[model samples]
Target: MEQNTAAVIRLESVHKTYHLGEVQVHALRGVTLQIRSGEFVAIMGASGSGKSTLMNILGCLDRPTKGHYWLDDADISHMSKNELARIRNRKLGFVFQQFNLLSRTSALENVELPTIYAGIPPAERHKRAREALERVGLGDRAEHHPSQLSGGQQQRVAIARALVNHPQIVLADEPTGNLDSRTSVEIMDILQRLNEEEGLTVVIVTHEPDIARYAMRAIEFRDGKIRRDQEIEERQIAREVLPTLPSLEDADAEEAEEESKVAPGESPAKAPA
Candidate 1:
């Protein structure tokens, strides 16, 4: 492991296996993956395909049975639970299908949780959380609770919380799974913006091909190994920014109506025109 390198995640011959009764279940069999700083990747797999296991390993939440794993020059495969906890708190951010906002907490406070864990001053934490919310176009909803926000808005707040730490990489698991099609597209647009405008490295695990299409590269996992890895074609050339949920709604409604005119079972979310 070299110092000052740009690669944030590197795994070599990683293997993860679990023992169930007298049987052994290999979740990740000899996996190797590397993510450079600023890369946007999507991991695609069916249920029980080891994608989640790999994500856990990358996120430092679980250890591999064998092989080397490095995060920014630190070999973490042998780190103690406390060391892994510290590293996860500092270097990683997470967004889930469920927004996972705290109950009885305002959006601003939800976004402040990570910094609070680091023992940052309250004033500083609030300022950074506010900026993070603004980055995701949720500045006006800071005072609202998660229950008060729409699905997309809640996800935005969750995203803001993830970025509040200025983490080097964001680990997203089924980030859009709970949203409607239009709303899912909206969330993907926000993530793409964060990657392009802020140079945030993002790695998402998803089962939907449409959602995975938003990522720059897609890795397919099958039978505990990578089946395919390649850059995505038809990369979105330009993404439109909407300042509010109403604007997105209006745009989506108009687009859906237009698509309705083009025979049944067709979707206009694929392209605006």
Candidate 2:
């Protein structure tokens, strides 16, 4: 993807502090960064490193305690809760580790949620949702509930939901965390295609080095500050990597072997014993 020089997200000396009882917890300390339009960025850090806090601020889910944030040309540092909600629905899409789909809802209905919040017309919302599902390669599975889909398919539906709103930026927090290695790459492949083919700006928070390599740029956070920011010289192309990974059939066979090790009535979670 050709990187656009225009900055879509800019944070100047951003700081976030939490007051828990009488103690203060500093989540972000004067962190400043810019993510240009059409760029794929990975934010990496260990637990308590504040990467999640930064993502929340960028997604307009939370306001910074100090410093300024400019999304495109508007400064949203002081936007009210309702205003922030409006901006989130209009400009941003989010994917999380949990997939976060409604258990009883079909994938198409799940993807239509953001549009409903945006007050899109019902007819248009259905059309957009179907198109988004097709974009994520889940058009055939649109009527399936989350329970009927595999872990990878579920995440793809979540990705479809994110795209249904036609958001300028997609913010994903540990999007592949719950999946196996091959499935993780599959999710990254979808994100890569979205960025390269659709020209969508992508930002993901991940701790896995292999997953981080899929991003064009990597930003490492530590102790509430950015410790490193650099382009990935040997960026992994997900489409290329996918062919080398274990095939879905192979993964399924392995999974079946593991399931056989557990007694028929026993939960997989208790198989180790």
Candidate 2: where is the Cα deviation over 4 Å? 1-5, 248-273
Give the Å shift of residue 93 in candidate 2.
0.5
Query: Residue by residue across 149-246, what tens digits does model 2's lDDT show?
Result: 76677788899999988899999999888776777888999999999998999999999999999999999999999999999999999899989975
lDDT of 1 at 82: 90
lDDT tens digits by residue: candidate 1, 1-273: 442377788889999999999999999999888888888999999999999999999999999999989998899999999999888778898998877888568999999999998889999999999999999999998998765666667788899999998988899999888766667778888889888888889999999998888899999999899999999996652254234333556656655545433522222333332
The 0-to-1 C-alpha lDDT of every candidate, in the order given, reads: 0.84, 0.88
Name model 1 segments beyond 4 Å from true: 1-5, 237-248, 251-273
